[model samples]
Every structure is written in structure tokens, then in C-alpha cells.
Target: MNITRRALLAGTAALPLVASAQTASGVGRRTMNHVKDHITRLVDQHRDGVAPIVSLGDPVLRQPADPFDGQVDDKLLAEFIELMQRTMRAAPGVGLAAPQIGVPVRIAVLEDPATVSDEVAEARHRYPLEFFAAINPDYRPNGHKRRGFYEGCLSMPGYTGVVNRPYSVHATYTDPTGHPHHKTFTGWQARIVQHETDHLRGTVYVDKLEPRSLSTTENYLDNWNDPIPTRAAQALRFHLD
Candidate 1:
């Protein structure tokens, strides 16, 4: 199915002044330090630079990630961000979360060049999004409007299911530079944002997917590769809003 290109499309910066305040308490400090050390060890263990992705059944994927405070110094955070970007690209996914790589921090990177057939692009409302990092990111649905499509994840390889998500969202997050951003995302970009942010909350698409819609990647490619999920929803006897 060339899933990486079809499914996954899925940043860094300096030491900012905010880390000190966010991690000021002794307990918070300790937690951040532990997370930092763990990340360091993971990086060191993967001499090849791309850390192996943790998959389903791994406890790390189910635990809510700690908020990114000054857990690691700016340099280390930059290195980690680069490492994440490398791993995500290697996974051939459009987005990746920290926990996916065994770092349980509220961070994720996402980008989609929107390189799909014109029919798919139009049907999916897919467009190109420049690569960027989202630290401590979150989102709210813009309205009741929703769309469903076959979704896949790097952490849950070889499977896809129909998951309906808000068509638009109001997203907020900090950039790698420590600056905060508030923006609106629509279409496929909104889906990508929600997917990655959900990871920080210890949620996966499967939790919300239509169970009957689950299919192996090969089957998805062979029988349900439509740009939209209408056919899958009907065949699977699931309702889509």
C-alpha cells in the first residue's frame, strides 16, 4: 500500500526562559530530569541515530506523556527533535509523537507534502503542510462537522481502520523556540494534528475506530483505497457523520 506515503506524512530550537518556571518545583524538576536522562539513554543506545519506534502493547504508548518543561537542555532537546524527525520520516508517517519513540513527553512533529493523486487530494482535502514541531500541543474541535477515512499509525503498523475526526480544529501549542502559537487547521491537516496530539494523551486511533472497519494494510490497499471512507463505512455497517 506504500502506506508511509499514503498514511504517514509525518523541528527544534534554543534554550528558552520558560523552562525554569515550568519545571521549578522539586518534583517537577526531578521528573523532567528523569525524562531527560531516559531520552539521552535512548539516543545513546541507537548509535544509528534513528530510534526504533515502540509499538502497540508497549506501556509507554498508553501512558500520558509529561509536559515538556526544561526536561532537557536546549541542545539535547534539539538533538532529540532531530532524532524524532529522522525516525518519523523513516517510519514514512505523516506525524509522530514522543511516546512513539519511548520518550513520554508532550511533543510531536508533522508534515505532509500532499503528494497524492488529484482525485485523492480533492476528496480528502489534503494539502501540503510544511514540516514543524508542536510542543505541548492540543486542539479543540471547531464544529460538529466530521470526516472519516482509513487511518494508520507508525506505532500500529500493518493495520488501518476507519476513524472519524473533526474536519476543523483550533490548535494551540509552543514552538521549538519557546514561543506559543494559536491557529486553525482544517481538512487533512486537522486530522494529522488530532492524531499526533491524541498520542500525548495516551490515545490511539483504534480506540475510536469502527471495529468492523479494521483491515490489514494489504486488504486496505486492495479493497478500500478510496479517498473517502463512505464505501468502507457502508460495507462495515458503520455510520459516519
Candidate 2:
């Protein structure tokens, strides 16, 4: 869902999307140059070099991000990844995608210390994930299993909704060093991977969320803070499966 102007002005919107680096023939030099220039201008605006996270209404967030086809040199790409990681941590979010930073590229960084109460952790199947970048990442559901939980976005700020996602997924992505990797992620980590990958495709959690389950952050904390979303599902009259 789109954030209201009031929320955007309040600077409450959440984190950004990711992409891969590989040589490709279709990407024009001119386009890459423009992207480089755009990134430079964005980074220049902040003293700490952290690009401001783009909000929901931004066109960049709605458009599909380009694949990281040598858009910038290795040094610049590294700096951008580091900037994204810093932005995610500053946003205090578990993940961030490139589109959130106004860069329409298939790139994202994710990490979660999973510092929560035991009950919450167990209910959500939450666990710590080491920081890693996913470029041009894609995933496929491993089975029919799915799980629903409260989800929020940095771009959509101030709201949370119940989203059912595949319980596990087999994912493929290229790392910053241009090496390809494949792995299966389960539980909360699978959810994080799918969420970021969807950004590269111009999708957001709201698109897949239970609309009736939507709640302002305050309401969510006050009324529906259960480890599982059973109470919310019952009260909201929404099916979770």
C-alpha cells in the first residue's frame, strides 16, 4: 500500500530492493552513465553518504529495477552495497532493496540478529541471518507449505499487515564478487528472500497482504501484538491459509 503524504513527511517510511552483476549486451553505455550520475547525485545529498530511502509514491519504486549489468565499476558497486547496508541498519530494518534508495537495480542486502523474546521467535520461526547482498536474485517455492505473519515495509511505513508466504524456497543469486550461488531458505529467512526479490519485480508486501488485517503500527503494537496472527485473523475475519 502507498504511504500517505503525512507519513512520508514524517519520515517514517521503511527500507529498499536488490540486483545481480554480469556482462550483458543490451544495456547501453548511455543508460549506465545516467544511472551512475543519478547515484552520485543521491549520495551527494547526504553527508554520511547514505542515500535517502525512497517512499511508496516514488516512480522508481513502482518500476522494475534493472539487472546489475556492470552499471557501475566494482568500487562504486561496493560503496553502494555498503550504503544500502548502512541505510537498512539506520532504518533499523532487517533488509533493504536498491529501489528503496531510488536506484532501480536488482540489488538488496539483508541481515537480522533475530533479537526477540523466545515466544515471538518460536512462533515466527525467526532466526539470525548474517548480512549478505543478493544481486539479480530469484526464488521458487519449495513446496505447497505457507505461513502467515505480520509484515511491514520501510517504503510503506506506519502500517503492518498479515502476509502469507511460502514456508521455504530455493533461491539463486549472484554475489557482489560476480559468483553465482544457490541455496534453500526456510522459515523467516525464506520470507525475507522472497520479499526482497519481489522488489526487483516491482512488487511489495501490500500486494500480497490480507487487506483487512492492515493496522497502523500503534494499533498493531497495542491490539494485535500476539506472537502469531491468530487473534488478528479472528478479529479481522481473514483466513490465513
Q: What do the candidate models score in CA lDDT, each in turn? A: 0.81, 0.79
TM-score of 2: 0.87
Clashes of 1: 7
Judge candidate 1 against the unseen true structure and give its global Cα lDDT, from 0 to 1: 0.81
Write the residue-wise lDDT of candidate 1 on 86-169 in tens digits: 877766778889898888899899888777899998998999989999999999999899998878888887788888889999
In every candidate, how many clashes are there?
7, 16
1-241 per-residue lDDT for model 2 (tens digits): 2222233234342121122222244335555676788766666666375667777888888888877777778887887888888788777678888999888888999888777789988988889889999988999999999999888788888887889999999999999999999999998888889888888889988899999999887787778878898999999998796
Deviation of model 1 at 127, angstroms: 0.5
23 in model 1: Cα distance from truth in Å? 9.0
Worst 10 residues of 1 by lDDT: 8-17
List TM-scores for all candidates, in order: 0.89, 0.87
Q: What is the lDDT of residue 160 in candidate 2?
A: 79
TM-score attained by model 1: 0.89
